[model samples]
Target chain A: MLTKRIIPCLDIKDGRTVKGVNFADLRDAGDPIELGARYASQGADELVYLDITATQQDRRTFSALVREIARHLDIPFTVGGGISSINDVAPLLEAGADKVSINSAAVRNPQLIDELAREFGSQMVVLAIDARKSGNQWQVFTNGGTQPTEKKLFSWAKEGQERGAGEILFTSMDHDGMKQGFAIDPIQKLSRLLNIPVIASGGAGRQEDFLSVFKLGEADAALAAGIFHFGQLSLPTLKQYLSKNGVIVR
Target chain B: MKTVIIKYQGGNVQSVAFALERLGASATVTDDADTIRTADRVIFPGVGEAGSTMKYLRERKLDQLIPSLEQPVLGICLGMQLMCRFSEENNTRCMGIFDVDVVKFPAKPLKVPHMGWNSLHNTKDWIGDSLDGKFAYFVHSFFAPLNPCTVAEVTYGRPFSAALRTNNFFAVQFHPEKSGDSGMRILKAFLDQSA
Candidate 1:
């Protein structure tokens, strides 16, 4: 009876939630705590907080923001972006993040995934991959998709899972922001390939797109930013749509 | 009521503390036997390997202290697994509170880490029928099978004990703190028992 998850992502910059989050109720809409609480109230399965702020001072601010969000919301949230070392993960988790997603760091040193999974549990480590398709094969990209590595998407995913990653957050760089739909072929491939739950990220435009990702893509979860951020889509409405379509959603 | 979260080396203590805080209760994370014994309620929270965790507990004499305590006790995830008589995880022996064996999920078709939101049905009335069919978050590879101590059952590959109750001891394999409103209700209900 495991239900598919629907997650709304919040990108944080300068201690303020930037990017696609466009909430009108809170006078200070930048406050991630309010946004997270609203999403939980509307029945979001989980929330993802991506800290894009880079700097020693800003990382501290992001950690503090994570504490605020964890304190305010009852649902589980994963913290990602700019997480590099063991030190970076400890504070966010201590501040009450259920899981920490490592992207570029994991790509840089695959050992970091093992180390974090050892320090915390495998269930606490999420390996986030930003992949771009190249000539019949999808390549792993790092540094926010600016740098492409020689590592193939499937191999790196298998490696991450073998290294004790509890879950895989696979985001297709080519389909990202395009709103065309999720990278179904790659997602379905990964879903069939890996035992861990695959969270399909990037390019989720409408409610039906989530259905496609869940039914066709076979993704355990579907994450979106713009559509949910701009109030174009709501978690309740999307979940209801999926439920009506014979998909079990919670 | 005095509440104390039994602290071992490995566990997600902060989130559990925050969950209680939201329910208007404050708790201290401590390993001191006296603190645990004195508290009106004790929550043993964990997320780690079985053999090593049991070793840590025995080294600190918590293995002896935990079972001896006379108060309402609730175990979460690994905590609940450790309270069982035995665990297939590292072949570690556990406290005999639940009289069950924690075994790993079967390979193939069913994932090892049965991680996600799953609802509990066929629940005993002790935890109430309110949580019946309500989704509770779960993230664990090993599970305690359906037994006499089981208060509620959940189906992944098959029916497993999602929540168990015996005397004053209440335990759940799910993380209520991260399970939204339905999870909060479960926590609140446990608190009501102590009250």
Candidate 2:
């Protein structure tokens, strides 16, 4: 039986790790490499480094930071944000990233997903969808959750799977950083809809939130930022809690 | 000393080389027999269909050359499957280095490709100490059944061989390259083995 994964997401800007309250009011965390090593040692199953800044200068800095983080830990790390083309993925994977995640670029050009899945196996490409509830439907959001998409969540997820996305990292814009809990309804719906593994992100206030996602939402993994960054919950402690709750974790 | 990664139209060699470089070991990626034969340790890392990979290996005469190696050799993922007797994928014949057959998971609601972290139990030899009940990442649709060569086991819808060892040749169905520190420790242990 595969165990549930615990991931720590480090949002990067200007080569430094930062966290925000609902993707606003960015606050510096620490050097990315140092923080990545710390998380790896703390038993984070994987690390996600997303470059929040869209500028060319920050992109270069983010790439440099990825190399530094890759140097410090021997774990699977994913690099996302500002990934526009097939060419964009090569540098990050070359710089020691195990996987490259795409968001806005993938939505704009669904063909890019197939192209990437052909070039690099589907396992190397991760599709990250930021979703927000719109009326009765959960809709896709882009541009750091500031822009909304017309595509329905289920349709986009199905397309992503068909286009060969190895994994789906789903983040609920409404629950992000609030830590009240995960947006279980959307996650359960998407997980049932997609064949690929779904990693639920956002709204993990306590360890039970992770348990809730795995048991109720059927998520393959859970990714948290603020709880991990602010030292409110540690990976080991969370794993222990999940294990006690009858959820297999490692 | 530089490590040589046998490039046979597989996957994860770049990441494996990069991981080694971070661990203070320089690595060379090539399919050249001479380069592989002369390297300190040869890593046969692959990810793809079994028959096709073996076809490529035989085309380059590496199929015969790999088994003759006296140095430590590590096989990852599909590389491990090709090192076995036969694979269920496409009903293909394999290298037969290990006396086991790769079979598809029994049909059910369970996913075909068992993807994610799973614990390795019932171990032996070099892998026994590090991976007993320890989680390692796995992603495969087919698996090699437990046999005399089975070193570690992981349960995913069914219990199967996660690691297998036969003399100087060690193969793991899971990607130790992407399996985090415990995985790195396995790599370091393999590198430290005495040939």
Candidate 3:
């Protein structure tokens, strides 16, 4: 049986991890590769690095960072952010990033998904949709959640599935950074609506949150940043908690 | 050891090369038949569609050369699928190194692609039960149903071949390179002990 994944997402800026992590053993917390390898060693099923830096030089640095991470960490990892073009993807993948997620650029050019799925297999293309609840409907947001798009959550996700995205990493803007719980409703529906795995992100305050997301929300994977970064919740502990509660975790 | 990874139109080829590098064994990624045949061990690694990959292999004459080689050859993911007799993926006809045929997973109850980590059970020859009960990363929609060549088993909807071994040919559906320490051990054992 396929086990649910616990992923620690790191925000990268100019080749360094942007978030302030509080792991005592980590010599350099800002280093993505070190942090990533640390997580992998600690039993993290996978890791995601969101390259927030938009500079051309940063892209080069990010690519190098990805290669270093790949060389060191044996677990699967996905690299995203500022990845807008088909040209931008190959370098990261060649650098040994397992998968690349696209947000704004994919929404701006929907064909990008089709092209990426065509060029690379659908397995490597992750469609990350940032959305917030608006008047009883989940509206898609792009440009780091500052700009709203004309796409709805369910429809756009179905569209992404049709366009050959292997997985859907849906981050709930409404519940983001609130540390309450994951947006279980939409995620449960997303898992049912599409054949691909649905990764529930945001609103992960506690290990119990992961259990709910994997059980109630039916998420194939759960992704979080702040809680894991600040050492509020460790991956091994979280996995133990989830496993104790009957949620299959890797 | 002159280890060579067969290079064709495939992704994850670089990853296998990197994994070998980490194991302190540098492998050459090449399409040259002479290099592949001359190598002590050949790693046939790939991630791609079966029909297209097979087409590329045939075009490059790798289709003919791969099976004919006597050296210990290992196939990973799509490379393993392509080693079979046939594939449901785009109705692809594959190199018949393994007698089994690949079929898509049942699309109900559980998700396709059987993504993420799962334990390997019911082991046999070559690797034997040494890796039994250990977790390995798997990602695939199609699977080669249990056959005589199956050395390891993984159950999703039903039991399927996690690793298969026949003569000098060994193949795995899981990405041992991406399965962390347990995975590295498999690769190390393959390099050190496989004859």
DockQ (CA atoms), all models: 0.80, 0.49, 0.72
lDDT of 1 by residue, B1-195 (tens): 899998876688888999999999999999998989899999998888889999999998999988887788999999999999999989999998888999999868976689889999988756688778989999999999999898999999899999998888889999998898888888888887752
Global CA lDDT computed for model 3: 0.88
Weakest 10 consecutive residues of candidate 1 chain B by summed lDDT: B122-131
For candidate 2, give the docking quality class from DockQ.
acceptable
Docking class of 3: medium
Better of 2 and 3 by DockQ: 3
Give one digit per residue, the lDDT tens place, for model 2 in B1-195.
657999865366667886787677888889999998998899999766677788999999999989888888999988899889999988999888889899987635675457778888997798856568888888777899888998898888778899999999999998887778778888888888886
TM-score of chain B of each: 0.97, 0.96, 0.97
Q: For every model shown, what is its TM-score relative to the native structure?
A: 0.96, 0.91, 0.96
Candidate 3 stretches with Cα past 4 Å from truth are A20-29
Evaluate candidate 1 and give its CAPRI docking class based on DockQ.
high
Please write out the lDDT profile of model 2 over residues A1-250, one tens digit for every residue: 6888888999988777899999999998887888888888877888899998857677767777777777667668889999999878777766667778999999999999998877767777789999888889888988888888897778998899899888899999899989899999889988888777898998999988998999999999899998988899988889888899899877
**Predicted candidate 1 versus true structure: per-residue lDDT over A13-130, tens digit per residue:** 7777666312212222356888889999999889999887667888998888888888888888999998999999889988889899999989889999999988888999999999
What's model 1's TM-score?
0.96
